[model samples]
Target chain A: MNSVAGTGLARAVGRLRGSGRSAIGRWFVIAVPYFWLALFFLVPFLIVLKIAFSNIQLSMPPVEPIVTWAGDKVFQLRLHFSNFTFVFGDDLYRAAFLNSLQVAGISTLFALLIGYPMAYGIARAPGTWRNILFLLVVLPFFTSFLLRVYAWMGLLGRNGPINGVLLKLGIVAEPLQLLQTDFAVYLGMVYSYLPFMVLPLYTAIEKLDLTLLEAAADLGCRPTKAFFKITLPLTKEGVFAGCLLVFIPAVGEYVIPALLGGPDTLMIGRVVWDEFFGNRDWPVASALAIVLLVILAGFVLLLQKVQAREKEAA
Target chain B: MTGRRSFFVLSAMVFGFAFLYLPILSMIVYSFNASRLVTVWDSAHSPTLAWYVELFHNDQVLDAARLSFRIAAVNATGAVILGTLAAFALERYTRFRGRTLFGLLTTAPMVLPEVITGLSLLLLFVALDQAVGWPSGRDATTITIAHMTFSLAYVVVVVQSRLATVDRSLEEAAMDLGARPWKVFFVITLPLIAPAIASGWVLAFILSWDDIVITSFVSGPGSTTLPQLVFSKVRLGVSPDINALATILVLIVSVGVAILGVYMMRRDRRRARDAQAAFAVIP
Candidate 1:
């Protein structure tokens, strides 16, 4: 009777442990990512949303966090639209936004111009040299970005190398006034972002079927015609991908302009910086940030729709 | 295919390489240029080692370099772990309703403009302080957090691609042989994907090392990075010491990539020779 009782107890313990292990396994697969992204990524965005609506008066230390309503009605928090109004109220912010769009758009276009053919060249190069070419394209990115931009300062400044070289070569009797100009800013932007454009384009173009080009050639398409009709159409996905990669980030760029641009190159990013650090206007900065986010989100949605369409067509 | 086409392509390729390398090569060569001005091209200038020596003695630059390395090391390791986990869960788990959205979230940090990411992170820090009174400040800790958030996205992409190509049957075969899922994953999946992990780690490290925008916004006082230091210095006055630093960076990166290339080339040649010998035997 005691042996029978012992066997029963063992069976029960074994079953309990097995269930526990399986439960732990199931929970592990779900809980880890959920809590992590929530705490770090998703929650941070939510916090931004909350603070954007919160009054600065309630945000002080000791952290009681009171809120006010119209006609002295009290609440714990209130959503305010005044911050958005304040951002749009000023011409400076509006100009900054427009300038940012123009710079990012133009620079992205230029980057594509240089990067697309370069990516094609690298993709079509002998297999032995392909990795080296790709590595070269990306090597500049591994260095100090600020320093690289700073290096351009030496190359573009009034007394810098470019001007000095030009003077010696007798191309210009005097400095061409390249520094602090839109041309300099665009140069810096394209130089920094060109790699981004090339990589995606390279990946996309490398996957192209050589037979397609052959097929076009056999169908009486000239070499240039083959490239334009077959190669370019097939590579459109990559082209758009590279453009988005370059354009999205360029839209919010502040550093290139900050380092190379003159007063005329007032980007929204710099405006955001000035609002937060220079002016200590947290609410206004948050509002501008939201505006930027909304714009970016729209762009992203458009990109997604385009990608989905491409995938379907493929 | 045509001679004309080949000529055009080759010339374009040459110009591309030249355009990319000239400024960098000039920076490297001019680092040793004896003249203070970087432009003048005369052998009589007698290349000197003065700037490199000066760079070693510059306390500010040295401190900033040390700090940058330390932060990058920590950020890269943290990102690899978090990113690998997230990628594993997304890839191995059954497809869910919100999988697309979750995938988008993982990549969103990367796609969004750096200015927005950095600014939003700053705002998040302030909100956290007000809400919980913890992380009541921003410092290297905040900087590391910001770096990891973005770097993790990169690691996930690298690992996810590798995972996608993996033969799921291998893991299923292990399970059929009586290994538990966890044991199979640990013993089989991790070992098979080790190369991906290594590549991801290297890529993450490079990203953190080169980061400036996010670091600029979130880094605390006295936490000035190498790039930030160079930025400030250049803004004040262009210095040849910076050129020396740039030259050193280029050399290190070039050497690293060259070694990787050499190893890959040797491996490819061996594999090709083995294939040819096998074909000879078949014939």
Candidate 2:
């Protein structure tokens, strides 16, 4: 089936290149999406980069253009490295960057710790139950993400259910300060992104050959040892994929930290928001965003390289 | 040992699912609270549908929901069309010039932070509006366009994966029988991958509907989406009306997903049976 498809696709490609009308059709298919993405996605990034080098102004658009035209001729060109330098030199921006990394990294770790077990359990369940379990995992994902976070707010507020339960059980003298803190932020992150982690992990673990574990057990290996030596190593790609899925967005998560986090909880996402909207500093916001894009792009490239190597190895 | 392992697995599953569903469950419960305060539950008062009533009547909420639905519907359709084309180009063509760049452009949005994407797009709109008198100001068009950009990435990934697993012989056999390439795609490939496209549409729709960050960034005065409205409201404080709205959204989404799931499951069963019957004939 696969080989036939390969050859068929190859032949189609050949015909596409050789024939004029079909070639135009193929080009049209490619060109439409290509142009849309180039204009909307790629050009926007360049615009961001360009704006990052411009100086903030109190004018209509709130930024001084890097290039100016006087009567269709070049008037003057001014590029500001000040925005980049300011972001680098400021402790506020630096702390926000570090804090975002820390929050995202910790939340991702917790998600993995929780998600791995659930995914493994789902994979090992009776075949009929596996689909239902997978559905349940994804069901929450379809619900509004903002609503889910709001649900968290209700559950963790000072007068909320968690505090009520804790107070009733005499766990503490007073209601625990669960809301508007890093703890709440982390909880929100883990809750919201857990599905992201589990979906990939379940896909990986479900595809595992159980007979390999049986073989190890027949060879007198303990279940724990067999799991460590066999299952974990095999599902490493899922772990990586799940981690990347959670970590990338969590790093720039604004809603969670804004709603759940205290004033002290500084994430680069919220910082960028304030810079753009609150402070009306488009250039600085653009600068901060460019820095984030650079980091994420590097990580994405690295992930792609790793996946390619794995494909080659396979 | 087996008993112990099963126990562990069972316990983990219970705890994990509880953690996942409890917040949503609580929200649903509290949405019924007769009191205005969301966190307070008093048995003295009877549970009321007052908040739901208010939710139906609120012009702001109703308007926002209407706008969000319109944008999501349009964005989902656009994303699916653009995404399927991109997916086909990548999977079938395989060696087009600048394919690497095309691949990156389509896929990067999948993982790019919403903050960055939103900020960059907003900047682009502002720049473009200034440079050329187009997109005059941020509105539903801009929001839909931004939503489509990110949603397109997701649709591409979903459709491309399905395309990867599709049997090539189906198209090949059709071509051998003298079907045009376009006819083969529409009659053969399209029907085969129809399930993927359907799910892609749903995913895009949901993503666009639930998006707050990007919409908030690009939306001008009259283009606030439901999520953006909810976010702003929740930020100020939780209102029972928002809870009622959330409950309704949950119900709608749950029903939608359940329908899709059952449909997919039935289709899978029929496909599997057909495949088995075909194999039996060959034998």
Candidate 3:
């Protein structure tokens, strides 16, 4: 009876899989989001690219339209590469971009150093405890992002708990310059993005085969050695994924640097925000954004290629 | 098994959690301080709920909260419908023309910097309004749409993962038994993936609610979301009432997440039992 039922299930699945109507279903699933995104997500980049070239004018929208319908059959196209030149030429823009890259890279390193063991611990924990631990990791994520950053302000303030502890413990006589510094910015970045690092690593570590480690152990390999050989290579993708997750957001992180860092700390996200709102340089801001997108898109495509290669090798 | 939980790893877990929760716990503690200044503690009238009362009475906060809630709700619903469709396409229909572009669209938002997305989207809206007289202004309508675009990517991530794990044989079996593709999806696939969809909804809602960057660009005057309002207020310095607001938000989220977690675990166990029973009858 069981054999017959299994055959029936297989036959049913096969027939449905081959059905022509399923093709319509497939298209229905694909077309809706495809159209929605093509209009909303993809087309916006085209507009950004267009606006990046057009001259900024004191109009209501703050930029002249790129394509103007000059008298019949003569549509004038204005392409000013000055915005790109200005973004590239400005020392401030270059500094902010490089600083952002540096800050994000270092923060990604810190998060990985902190997140990997926590993820491994949680992934290896006993069943019920694992879920509870996972929930605990995710709990803060459900709360207000701004408030958590605000919390850091309180904690790192001269009059806050950290200072109080330092003074009471006789560690220092005066309050440290904790807030409005690069240290505070990095700390906030690591804290905000640690969960993003941990989650992917946890998923990867959880799927790791234990028997391989056991086999290595039986062959008289040290635990650390076995881990280095069997585990590290296997979870490299997760680490890379986690690093990307942290790095991308951290590079463009505005709230952390704005709330936590002082005047000297420069980030490109802040630069873009200032140019668009403060300076009212729409074209330059659009140009900055376009460059940022190109760089990020390059990284993403590179990751995709590497992952595809890994899959093929596997 | 014994080697799995090393002293180093266990300590790391403890330390990691401490780093995560200490900021929040301090925030909650400071919210109740009697002093007007958030950083200072007044020993005489400590642990007052004065700020909570102030939060309730603040008209700006109340209005902004209402706006954020409205936008988040609308965004969540729109994102789920679009996200589910996208997830079904990516997971079930693996091979198709433009599949690469479709996948890129679905995932790119997750990694795209908000400033770029916001700037580009604002430009798109401006050009669209200029070309066609529809969506004549940037307001809650535009903010909600912007939120949906980003938040749907998250919804897709969640729902697509769930879809990948779902037992496809059940869906195919129903289709083979003469149920229409749409009907099979509605009746069978939907139930199986409902938890993911629900979580996706909640995630989308929170992301939209918590967003400041995108909303700052897209939202016009008088359409201030709670985060934007709070951001503008707190950009200068900290305040006691914002702490009160934070504490309240954390409490609400904790309760909601706890309930969802427990419910999902129970459902999973019950489903496991049902599967066992069904297989027993088959044998």
Candidate 4:
């Protein structure tokens, strides 16, 4: 009896030590991720904001201003909101911003239309085949993204295989000018982002109970009606999440437009790139960066609201 | 059974895969084409391995390829280590406050636009140079750091999921048997999460390998990575050499994937066999 009590006491002490160790470990965990983000992410945004509000004379340090503000004394180093006007006032910048929105909007729509069916198919696939389907969907991302786009270039080039085959088959009298166009930009963006759209949708669809669909079916709904009433509603979270994932990045995609888009297809990301590297306008670039962050932040809040509503509805 | 639904699904699946794969397939086939023009085929003309041969001999391509591989290896290793530790700290401890905030913070880098990420990294580099004179200018070191910044998020998620499923009793039993904390972790926990770490490493490597956006921001004149090289080339014009280079990259990646798949299959079989042995030994 005494030995058993001793064992119990030892166990209790062990539990106490474990809990104490875990408490310390937890703080370490919390600190590490927090520190990383603060140093890298939050600090970067803060830096962008600071730069956005500062004067951008080439010789002046990007961070510091020549003058300091003291109450009524206007300082060169002080915050300026003119950068916003610079962005909004420029007809080119406004056009690029609007073009970015349209391209992202359309590409996201196409990705959803294409990816939804693929995700649904994967979710409904046999368990043994599900992984293979998932891998197939994911495989394109593993390859060099540049090369993938280049491959599309090869296919879409006026004199490339797509045109050659079409001409040979007598489908069209002239070769389609597919490359270096807005159409090519849309194709590249949608293709590259399709996997991102599908994966999230798959996860959401996979979690859905088949009984709900069956119940809808048993309640005198046709297959299409049942899908609209049950399946679509059930996977709305994934659709929203996937759309957000695709749209946000697509809005900021510079590479696709830089390679595949025409001169007419100016995007905000490409414009920002030009500001920093080409234009050497650091303050304007920083202002653009700040605008992007605010927009993204808004988008994320919208996502969160949708997610919360989804949870409450559930 | 909805026949129409099944047919529509099947048609979509096949066409989608075809669209995804056909361009890749053509690229591979054209890599062996003897002619300079990739589109037109001359059946009578003999196929040559000259493009692959030229790919190995091209000085610029070789240098870029070497630089890319070195950066990827370094980033992958660093990300796996740092990310696995973060995962361990998150999973093994429960007393941490604001875990959800930490989780969101960790994932922020993943969702940030490449344009912004590159711009931020460039800004950080400028600030660091003015402050400490380290990473004197944008170079390979900066590139690797940028790659790790984003890739580490994915590694942590993969590792954390695996860690969450681990049975804690095993670690407790090891500690109860008088093992040190580190000893218990090494002996009881490390093996359990090894697969996750391996997967994470491979994923990180791929991300680092394929990264062009952030790398483009920080790469110096001569330090362009392979993807950056390809991007510059594609922007200028499509050359047959670029196609050759792409084919070789595809070959390497495809082989790596096949090897990983085979290894996973063999490991699964070995695990099944081991389980069978355990069952057979049971009374």
Name the candidate, 1 or 4, with the larger lDDT value.
4
Compose the digit string of candidate 4's lDDT tens values, residues A1-314.
99999999999998899779866755665576567656766677767777888777757354455247656766545678889998889998888878888999999999999898889888899854675677778778788788888888878887888899899999999999899899999999988889889999999999999998788788878999888888998889899989989999898898889888987789999989998888788889888877876888888898898789878877
Write model 2 residue lDDT over B13-128, tens digit each, in one string: 89999999999999999998988778989667748888998899899999999999999999999999999999999999989899999999998898889999999899889888
Instruction: Give the CAPRI class of candidate 4.
Output: medium
Candidate 2 predicts chain B with a TM-score of: 0.92
lDDT of 3 by residue, B1-283 (tens): 4455498898888999999999999999999999977888898998899999999999999999999999999999999999999999999887999999999999989899999889888988988898897578889999998999999999999999999999999987997687988899899999999999998999999999999999998888869999998898788888889999999999999998788679767877888899999999995
In terms of DockQ, which candidate is stronger, 2 or 3? 2
lDDT of each: 0.80, 0.92, 0.91, 0.83
TM-score of chain B of each: 0.95, 0.92, 0.90, 0.89
Q: Please, what's the RMSD in Å of model 1?
A: 3.3
TM-score of candidate 3 against the unseen true structure? 0.91
Candidate 3 lDDT, A1-314, residue by residue in tens: 99999999997887877676778777787998999899889999988898899889998789888789999899998899999999999999899989999999999999999999999999998866787889888887778888888899999998999999999999999999899999999999999999899999999999999999989989998888888999988998899899999999888888888899998799999989889999888899999998887777787789889989988998
Worst 10 residues of 3 chain B by lDDT: B1-10
Q: How accurate is candidate 3 locally (lDDT)?
A: 0.91
lDDT of 2 by residue, A9-62 (tens): 998987766476678879999999999999999999898888899988889799
Superposed by TM-score, candidate 3 places the C-alpha of residue A147 at a distance from the truth, in angstroms, of: 1.1
Q: Highest TM-score among the candidates is held by which one? A: 2
Better of 1 and 4 by TM-score: 1
Minimal lDDT window, size 10, model 2 chain B: B256-265
